[model samples]
Target: MTSDPEEQVRLQGFGEMTLRTAVATLMQLAPGERADAAIFRVRDDVRLAQSEIAELASHWGIEPAPNVRSPGLVPDQHWPDVVRGMVREAPLPSLMVAFLVGMLVARR
Candidate 1:
């Protein structure tokens, strides 16, 4: 919320850089690790909710869904490599897409 356009652009660039760095860091993590992290976050959230609503905790005995492995065109393990290859092959298009997404998110 700055009056200066240059300052706004600088801040936007910083935000985009931070987002890109976070994405790159996540991409470096193994798929299994990512899944585990997501599960942990959900577990923490559920624990917090249960703590806040003690009476509802008893009703929240939901079972986890069974893991059904579906055959994908590209196997799970190679996904990160394939995505990296795609971005390497078409850097400009990827950057444009990222920029557009950032703009849309910023507008919101």
Candidate 2:
């Protein structure tokens, strides 16, 4: 029901976490069941799509976002047109990653 796209994504992430927790609890409660049985039970009871459990497991187990690109190696082109505009009259350093990669270009 939110008009904000960021809010909707946050809500969706919260809902996914709740569902994952519930499924994990149920799996733990069924002590005698096989791992595959627990997966099937979750699929049948919660009506999730095929491979979604595996996908969720993979996603949840992933490490936090990697530092793929280094911050110090930013292109020279961004220094002029983009980085100069986000400056505030404070001591905080400018964040150029979003601007260098075009994330903040259209918004400005």
Structure candidate 1, residue pairs in collision: none
lDDT of 1 by residue, 32-54 (tens): 54333311111122211222222
TM-scores for all candidates? 0.22, 0.24
> What does candidate 2's lDDT look like per residue over 12-89, in tens digits?
112323444534443343233313333222223434432554455455552223333566775566666554664653
Candidate 2's C-alpha runs over 4 A off are 1-17, 26-46, 62-108
Using lDDT, give the best candidate's number: 2
For model 2, the local distance difference test gives 0.38
- Clash count for each candidate, listed in order shown: 0, 0
Model 2, position 72: C-alpha lDDT score: 73
